[model samples]
Target chain A: MDKLTPPVSGSRYSVIRAIIITWMTLVILGAFLLDIPRMNILEHTARNLYFHVPMWFTMMSMVLVSGIYSARHLASGSRITDIRARESARVAAVFGVMGLITGILWAKFTWYSGTSVWWNSDPRQSMAAIQLLIYGAYFFLRTTIDDNEKRGRIAAVYNLIAAATVPFLLYVLPRQMESLHPGADGNPAFSEITAPIMRAVFYPAVIGFIAIAWLLYRQRVRVAILKENLTSD
Target chain B: MRLHSGRTSWLRATVSVFLKDTRIEWRSRFGINLLVLFVLSSVFILVFALGQDTVERNVIAALYWIVIIFAATSSLGRSFISEEEGGTVLLLQTHVPGSAVFAGKLLFNLVLILIANVLASLAFTVFINATIANWPIFVVIVVLGSSGLAGATTILAAIIARTGNGGSLLPVLLLPILMPLLLSVVHAMIAALEPGSSWNDVGNDIATLVAYAGTVVTASVLLFDFVWKD
Candidate 1:
C-alpha cells in the first residue's frame, strides 16, 4: 500500500498562515481607520465596502477552487481531490453566508435608511440566497449516500452542475434585471463611483480575504487527510 | 450493446429509451395522472382562495410559474426512481450509454412538462381569466421554459433517485438550479400577458432561457457517466 503526502509542507504552510493572519488583520484595521470623503447615504457605513464586497470575492474564489478540484476528482478518482473539493465548498458556503449577511446589513443601513425594510428583494441578494441554497443541497446530497466512493462521485457531479449554474445566477441573470447594486441595469460600476484612494484598500481587502479563505480551506483539508490516514492505517 | 457506434447508435439508444418510457407511461399513465391532478387541484385551491377577485397579471404570472415549478420538482424525481425500484437499471447500464439515457429521460421529462404546462395554462385561462396578449412570445416562453426545467431536473432526478429519501431532497436540489429559468420565464410570461407586449420586450429573457437550457443539458450529458456508472 502507498501513502499519500501532504500537498503543502509544514514550514510552507506555517509561513502562508502567518502571512494570511497578518494581512487580514491589517485589512480590518484599514477598513475602519482609512478616511475618505463622506457621502450623504453611505456616511461611515461606507466602510462596509471593505468588508462586504470581499466576502463575495472570497466566496467566488472558494467556489472556483471547489469546482476545479471536483473536476480533477472526476478525472483522477483520487480521494484527496474529493476531500479538497468538499472542504473548499464548505468554506465557500461559509463565505457566501457571510457575504449575504453583510450585504443585508449594508443595504438596510444605506438603501433602506429611513424605513423598517430589511429585505427589498434586491436581485443580487436573491441570487446570493439562492447560491447558499445550492450549497446546502450539495451537503445534503453527500449525507444521503452511505458508500464513501459513491458519495464522492455523485456529489462531485452535482457540485459541477451547481458550479456551472452560479455564473448564470450571479452575473448573467442579475445583469438583465433591475438591481440596486452597482454595475447593474446600466448604472455606473464601482470603479467609476469609488474614489481612487479607496481602491488601494479595497483591492487588498479582496486579496486578503481570498488568501484567508484559502488558509481556512487548507486547514480543513489537512485535518480531513489526517483523519483518513489514521482511520485507514 | 454497441454503445460507441457513433451518431446513429446514440440516436437509436436515445429514441429507444424515450419510446420505452413513453410506452410505460402511456400504459400506466401514472406520471401524467399525478401531474394533471396536482396542477388542477392546486390551481383550483388557488382560485378558491383568491375569491374571484381579478388578480393582477404580475401576481397571476407568479402564481402560474410557482405551480409549474412545484409540479416539476415534486414529480420529476421519478425519472430514474422507477428504474431503480424495478431493478432494470442494471440492464439499462449494460445496454445503453449513460448519455443516451440522459437524453431519453430529458426528452421524456420535456414532453411531460410540456403537457403539464399546457394543461396548467389552459386551466389558468379557464379559471383565472388571464389573457395572453402575445401568442408568439407565449409559445416561445412555454417551450424554452419546459426545456430548461426538463434539462436541469433530469440529471438531478438521477442523482436523488440513488438516495433512498428522494422525495424531500428533489426540490431542495432543484429550486436553486432552476431559479434563473424560473425568473426569466416569469418575467417573460408577465410581458406576454400584458395587453401590448412585443418580442422585443423579452428578447434578452428568451436568450437567457435558451442559454440556461443549453448549458444544463450539455453539462448533464458530460457528467452523467459518473453518476450512472457507479
Candidate 2:
C-alpha cells in the first residue's frame, strides 16, 4: 500500500518478483514434463492447456485491471491513474497478441494438421482478434491528441467505451456461433473434461501468467512516471 | 436557463437539437446525399463484382450489412465535425446540456442510418434480386441494428471531431466496437432470409442487438459530458 511513485525497488517487490519467476519456471517445466491423459486429436498437445489457456485468462485479467484504472482516472483526473490505465492496457495488448499467436500455432498442428489453413475463422479466435483491434484503436486514439491532460481524459473515455463492448464481443456473440474451442455448443468445458491432475498446473499457470502481466504493468507505469517527472523538471 | 432542467425541457431541448440538425441537413442535403451516393455505388459495385452467380444467403447478408456499415462510417462522422467547422460547437455548447446534445445527435444519426440501411437493402433487392423471407424479424433487426450503430458512433464522432484526423479515425474506432452488433445483425439477416426461418430462429440476435444498442446508448449519455465539455 506504499506510494508507488518510485516503485523501482523494494524488498517486498524483489521478493514477489523472485517468487513469480520461480513459480512460472516451474509451471513451464510441469507443462512439458507432466504426464497428461491423452485423447485422440489433442494428444501431447493437450499440455498446451497449461500455457495457451492461461494467456487468455491473463489477458482478461489485464483487461479488467485496465478498465478499473480507466474508470478511476475518469473519477479522480489523476495522472497516476491514467498511467496505470495505459500501462495495464499495454500489458493486456501484449498478452492478447501472445494468446493469438499461440492459439494459431496450437490450432495449426492439432486441428488443421496437414492443411494450409492457419486461420479458420473460429468465432472465439475472431473475437480475440477483434478485441486486439479494440486495444489498437484505444492506443491509436491516444496518439491523435497532443495535450497530455486532454489525451488522458479522452483516451480514458474511449478505453471505457471500448471495454464496455468487450463482454458482448468476446462472450455473448461468440457463444451464439459454433466454434472449435470447448464450452461451445454443449461441449464439455475445461472443468468437466480436464483431469484433476491437470487442474493443479492449470490453476497456477493462470495465476503465474496474471502475476507476470501485473509486474509488466507496474514496470511500465513506473517508467512512464519517471519519464514524465524528468521531462517536467 | 437552468443547466439541469426538468425532464420535459430536456426532452424539448433534445428534440429542438434534432430538429435544428434536421433542418440544416434538409437544406444542405449533405448527409442524405453522401449516404445515398455511397449506398448506390456500393450496390453497383457488388452487382458488378458478384455477376449473375447465385450467392449464398449468408454472403448476401454479410454484404448487405457491410454496405450499410461503410455507408454509415462514411457519413456519420460529419455530424459533429460540421458543427466544429461552422464554429457552432461553442454556440451549441453554451445553449444545451451535453446529454441532450448527444441524444439529439443520436436521434439524427439513427434516422440517417435507418434510411441508409433501408435504401441499401432495397438496392440489394433490386440489383441482386435478394428477397426477405420474414418481414417482421428483418425489420426488427434493421431498427435495432441501426440504433446500435448510431448510438455507438455518435459519441465517437464527437470525440474525434476535436482531433486532427477525425475522418480517418472514425472507422478504426467504430468497426471494432460495432463488430458484435454487426455480427449479430448479419446472423439475424441470414436467418430472416432462410425460407423456413421464423422469429424463433433470430431471437438471440434480436436480444443481442437490443442489448448492444441499450448498452452503447446508456454508456454514451453517461460519458458524453466528458467528451463534449472539453
Candidate 3:
C-alpha cells in the first residue's frame, strides 16, 4: 500500500477545504478587526490565547482520547486498540511540549521582568510539570516491556490511574495554593473583560486551534494505519 | 474462566495472596532492608548537610518530608520487580482475580511504607532534635501521607515492573504523580511540629492528604483489573 495519497475531487474534500478556508479567513479577519485601539493591549497577549491555550486544550483532548483507548485495550486485550492509544499518547506528548513552550513565552510577556527565573514553583507550574513527567513515563514503561499484551495492559492501567492525578494537579492543587498566575481566587476572569470585539477574535482562535489539533490527530491515525498495513503485507 | 465465587472465597483468595506475598518478601529481605538502610543513611546525610546552625524546626520538618518521599519511592520501586523477575506475576495472575492481586500487593507496600515511616520519623526526631507537638496529628499525617504514597507507587510499580530498565524508571514515573501528596504532607508536618499550631491550622492539609489517599486508592482498585489482565 502507498503511504501517501491525495484526496479525489469530491464533495467531502470540498467541504473539508471549505471549512479550512473559512477558519483561516475568520482568524485573519478577527486579527485585523481586533487590532483597533481599545482592544490593542490584548494584541500580543491575545495572540497567545489562540496559540497557547489551544496547545493546552489540544493536549488535554488528545490525552483524554489516549486514556479512553487505553481503557478499551485493557478491557478487550486488543493490540490494535493499544496501538491507537500509544499513538494518541505520542501526539499528546508533542502537544504537551508545545503547550509548555507557549506558556513560558506567554508568562515571560505577562508575568516576568528582566533577569527573572524561567520557571517558578507555583502550584500550577509544578502540577503541569508533574503531569508531563507522569505521561513521559507512560512511554518509557511501554518500551521496557517485551511482551506486547502485558505492556499494553500495564500502560493502560497507568494511563487511566495517572490521568486521575492530572485534574488534581492541574486544577485542584493549583487553585488551593497561592500563586502569581492568572485565574487565582481574586483575579478577574479572562472572559469577563470589557472588550466585546476581542471576544469575537478569541472564540475563533479557540475553534481554530481545536481544528488544527483535530487535523493533526487525523493525520497521526492515518499514518498509524498505513504503517500497520505496510508491516502486515 | 471464573476465578472464584462468593464473597468469602474472594476474601480468602485476597488473604491467601497477601500471605503468599508476605512470605515471599520475608524470605528475601534484601529489597526492604536495603530500603530501610537507604532511608536511615539519607536522614543522616540530611542532618549533617543541614548542620546544627540550620536545624530550625521548619527546616527539620521539611527535611523529614524530603527523606520520607524519596525513601518511599525507592521502596515502592522494588515492590513488584522481584515478582515479575521470577515469573511469579504470571503465577499470581493465574490464581487470583486482578483486583485481589492488586489489593495484596498494595497492602504489602502499605505495610512496608508504614514501617519505613515509623523508623524514619524516629531517626528524624533524634537527628534533628525535633519533637512532634501534636502526636496524634503527626501520626495521622504519616498514615495518610504514606497511604497515598503506597497507592500511587503500587500502581506505578506494577506498570513498570515488566519494563526493561524499570529500576530507575519507577522513581521517574512516581515522583510527579505523588507531588500533591508530598506537598500536603509537608504542610501537615509543619503544622504538627509547630508549638502554636492548632488543629484548625493543619485541618486543610490533613483533609487534602486524606482526599488524595482515598482518590488514589479507589482509582487503583477500579483500574487494577484492567492493568493486570495482560
Candidate 4:
C-alpha cells in the first residue's frame, strides 16, 4: 500500500461544510417523504427514527473510536493518542445523552400512557440507564485524578474494561432478562426495507455528527494546549 | 531487607499480609464496627420501607437481595480505604506481588462479608419470617455470592483509591459492574430461601455466579499489573 498524505488542514473546511449541508438537506427531505408510506407507526413516530437511531449509531461509533484510541495509547504511550481517546469518550457521552433523551420521548409518545407517566421495568430502558451510568462513572474517574499521566492511563484502562461490559449489558444480559422492547427476537428497527431508507439519511447523519464532534474536540484540544503553553511561558 | 523468595515464601507472605490486615483492622475497630452497624441499619430501614404486609415471596426475596447488596457496598468500600488512608497500601505494594496482594485483600474482605452476611441473614429471617428449606444450598449461595462480591469489589476499590472523590465514585463505578453478580446471587438466594423451592430452580444463576467470580478474579489478576503500575 502507498503511504497516504495528510490533507491540507485549512482546506478541509470546504469538505466539512459540504457534508454538513448535504446532511441537513437529506434530513429535511427524509422527513418530507416519510409521510408517503402512511404506516401507522411510521407516520408520526417514524420521524424520530431519523434522529434517535442516528444518535445511538453515532454514540456507539464514537465509543468504538474511544476504545481504539485507548488501546493505541496503551500500546504506544502517546499523549496525543490519549487525548484523542479522551475526546472520543467525551463526544460519545454527549451522543449517549441525546440518544437516551430521544428514546424517552419516543417512549412517551409511542408506548407510554398518552396522558400519564410511562415508567416500567422495560429492559431497554433499564439497560440504557445502566449504560449511561457506566459512562458517567468513566468521566467521574477521569476528573477525580490529579496527575495527568496517571489519569490518562487509568482512564484508558477503564475505558477498555468498561467497553467490554457494554455489549454484555446492552445486548446479552437484557435478552436473558426478557425485556419488553420490540425486536428482541430480531430488531425490525434495522430490517431490510426500513434499514435501506434509514441508511439513506443515516450514513450522512453519522458523518455529520462525527464532523461536528471532531470540530468541537479540536477546539477543546487547542484551548488546552494554549493553556499549557501560557502556563509554561 | 530482601523479601523472601520461592512459592513457600510467597504463601508465607500472603498469610502475613492477611493476618497483618486482620490484626490492624481488629485494633482499629473502625471497619468492622462500621460494617456491622451499617448492615444493621440497612436491614432495619429496608424492613421498615417494605413494611409487614404479606407481600409475594418473590418480591420479598428481591427486596432481601437489594438490602444485602447495598450493605455489601458499605463494607466493600471500606476494604481499601483503610489501607490507603493509613499508607499501608504503599508499603504493601512494595512487599508483595500484585496477585498475592489481591488474594490477601480478597480473603480479608470475604471473611468480613461472611460475618456481615450471617448477621444480615438473621435479621432478614426475623423480620420477614424467611424460611430456608435447604440449609446447605443457602450456605453455598451465600459463599459463592459473597465471593463474587469480594472479587469485584477488590478490583473496584483499588481503582477508586486512585480517585479524588473515592467515597462517592466507588459505588457509581462498582454497582453497574456488580449487576450480574447481584442478580445471580439474588436468584440463588431466593431459590434457597423460598419454601418448596429447589436448588435446580436457581441452577443457572448459581452457575453464572461461579462463572462471574472466576472470570472477575482472572481478569483482575491479569489487569492488576497494569493498574498497579500507575
Query: In order, what DockQ does each candidate have?
Result: 0.71, 0.72, 0.61, 0.47
Error of 4 at B94 (Å): 2.5
- Taking every candidate in turn, the Cα RMSD to the unseen true structure, in Å, is 2.4, 2.7, 3.8, 4.3
Interface Cα root-mean-square deviation for all models: 1.2, 1.1, 1.9, 2.2
> What's the residue-level lDDT of B197 in candidate 2?
91
Please, what is the TM-score per model?
Answer: 0.94, 0.94, 0.88, 0.86
Candidate 1 docking quality: incorrect, acceptable, medium or high: medium
Model 2 stretches astray by more than 4 angstroms? A1-4, B1-8
Query: Best candidate, lDDT-wise?
Result: 2
Tell me the whole-model lDDT of each prediction, alpha carbons only. 0.87, 0.87, 0.75, 0.71
Which 10-residue span in candidate 2 chain B carries the lowest summed lDDT?
A: B1-10
- Ordered by TM-score, highest first, the candidates read 2, 1, 3, 4
Writing each residue's lDDT as its tens digit, candidate 3 over B1-230 gives 22453444767777777787788778988658877898889988887787776467667777787777777777778767878777777777777777887777888888888888888878887876788888888888998888888889888777666677766887777877777777778877888888877888878778788888899989998877665654
Candidate 1 lDDT over residue span B1-230, tens digit each: 33444455788999989999999999999999999999999999989988878999989999999999889877788989899989999988878888999999999999989988899989999998888788899899999999989988899999998785876789989888888888889989999999789888898889889999999999999999988987
**What is the docking quality class of candidate 2?**
medium
**Which has the better DockQ: candidate 3, or candidate 4?**
3
Number of backbone collisions per candidate, in order?
Answer: 0, 0, 2, 0
Q: List the residue pairs that clash in candidate 2.
A: none
Instruction: Supply candidate 1's per-residue lDDT for B164.
Output: 57
The candidate maximizing DockQ is 2
Chain B TM-score of every predicted model: 0.96, 0.96, 0.92, 0.91
